[model samples]
Target: MPRSPGGLETLDPTRQRQFSESGYLVLPGFLPEPLRARLVPEVDHWVDEGLRARSIAACAAPEAGGPPPVLELELAAHGELLTHPPLLRTLTQLMGPSFVFHHLHSDRHAPGIAGKPWHHDCEPNDRGDPALRMIHALHYLGGLDEKVGSLAILPGSHRRSADKTALAHLGTGEVPGETVIDRLPAGSTVLLDSALFHTRRPAPDGPGGPRYFIDASYCQTGARWRPVKPYWRHMLARARELGLSDSRWPELFAERHFTEYTGTV
Candidate 1:
């Protein structure tokens, strides 16, 4: 990724246009090493202690009137990544500065993990406005290589109006015109238009090692977007309590941008 002469992170118009047309942007070694270092252990702990499972269960049974003891954003390094300055600036260039966070998920995929079916992660906004955008920032703390599964994405797919599972029946099989991203340096991040069709394919030669992955999403303001987790209100409140967002991005964790939780979509 290109940086300013000063070595500061920068997003130029050309890259912005590419993201618009390709439905994704690949940032090689985007996160700083220190940040990655801190995030790795956190992911291990999140999974090893079964906190990740509990978080998922909270999403599944949100009506239980409770959430997990700790949210992903509440994790020190995870919160830092969520509001990382470069990420926020790049996002502002792509979708403007007024967007609200959708969700954050952290996981360490074990070797031999099964592939995920082809799908999109976009949650609909109640206004039925297609222009309202949502984007996912997929942080690969350990990077990607042959040892782990690669991500397959359909370029320009976000332009189409379709269900999140429109391509589910196809599973993780190859698709013509699809691009396979199998190699990246540690701390790399992939920014995807939330509506883009994508799939996770297992390592070509079988699993090798755990994949340290975390994904956070944000939606453009102006419409009330649906929430993926039933405990979304609590999630945002906690983010605010932890001061995860900066003064510039007050809406980053504001509850006003989301519609009432209607359970998992």
Candidate 2:
């Protein structure tokens, strides 16, 4: 529960060591109120308007063709969040000054939704360097508690060379040494090494409020990471055109860091 070093303006050595050892960092209330307020309504629109469904369809059958009408970052609040200066600074502290934006996903999980099995989200890099890093910033817009699902992560799991879903058989069942992160204020963000194993456990109660979640990922430079979406070029281009990455972060939205999209690995 070490909160974000307020704006992550200064990455203390202790916090850096904690992230290196634990493979994750919890930044409770990392986002400011205004940004989080804007994000909430946008997430409602994303889900209620069926844009999320259409985006899922596009990814499910890339060969079926055509990109989704909107990418998550194209939404005003989402676009702002993507390059939120404080966030970029925090990321730079962990992955160095150079890194590329990987992808962004926004969703609203309804009450009583089933749990997702334990899995790591790391995608492969053409270089196959374990030292290279891909980090995911998980935004919990409404925060988390028993009413919403809990996130359970195994500390130090990212060091293992296991397949992404190697622990799927265990489902959301408790695992020894796991860290359960169920209590946080609204606008918190948990930064994780994308290879770390984690699971989402459905709320224990029968019914509860929705969970507003959005995740965006980035990769350390020096290797070409796999692209999750077929329209990767368009995504990168739009980010660049929108000036998401400013002078300080030249590589944030660059396309050179990704390999060609290879349909839903």
Candidate 3:
């Protein structure tokens, strides 16, 4: 793929072909220094706050609760990061002309924090057609390496079936034959198909060390968008307050779709 000048090279014909065949590609140091510096601190702050909140909640109701809430920052709140020039340009190239920020969130893997299961971001219930639903961006904040923990993805696995056992084994240091561990420097960003099988490793031990990264998933605007319940309610009220006519409700609420699932094993 031809690298873009003054930007991470747009996935060139060769690179695009590779991605089509392989299911994932890494664009190293995609975000420039200044924007990365500015965004990293904000993401770090949000993750820290989320961790603290999760700790308190766990203490208050240890047995009743499930996993800690993965901190999420809405792009609407982080406008500068969302509208960053180079990132946006790259996204446009990857996803084509029209796309929407379907989801934006960050994860902070503290020491001993359990690693994530291998899973595709979009499954049958939620993903649109694979051809139009192209890329997701994972931005690394803290320095990442094998020891500090990094993302693990299955190359060419996007077209395969979702494996429950494979998901369970990702963080257990038992990667499947197709897996690739992404080792990235701080400020580097990786773009991959959301349907690709992937997982995050737990934080390794060290003073002043933890794994922090942001996952931003996008889909072509032509895809249906689904907001969660609370957000949907908020969107309804916001629309009314803005004096939007009822006719526009469908468009306003168009992106919100819910997923159905069987009981966890």
CA-lDDT, candidates in order: 0.92, 0.92, 0.57
Best candidate, TM-score: 1
- Per-candidate alpha-carbon RMSD to the true structure: 1.2, 2.0, 6.5
The deviation in Å at residue 120 for candidate 2 is 0.4
> Residue 54 of model 2: what lDDT?
94
- Clashing pairs in model 1, backbone N/Cα/C closer than 3 A: none
State the lDDT of candidate 1 residue by residue for 55-156, as single tens digits: 988888877869898899988999999999899888988899899999999999999999999999999998998888899999999999999889999999
**Model 2 Cα shift for residue 51 (angstroms):** 0.6
Q: Give candidate 1 regions above 4 Å deviation.
A: 5-8
Candidate 2 overall lDDT versus native: 0.92
In model 3, how large is the Cα lDDT of residue 218? 60
- Give the Å error, residue 143, model 1: 0.7
| Candidate 3 residue lDDT tens string, 27-101 | 666666776677666666666566636634543554564534432333223444544555666666666656555
**Candidate 1, run of 10 with poorest lDDT:** 1-10
TM-score of candidate 2 to 2 decimals: 0.96
Q: Give one digit per residue, the lDDT tens place, for model 2 in 80-187.
A: 998988888888889899999999999999999999999999999998998998999999999999899799999999998999999999999999999999999999
Score candidate 1 by lDDT: 0.92
Each candidate structure's count of clashing pairs: 0, 0, 8
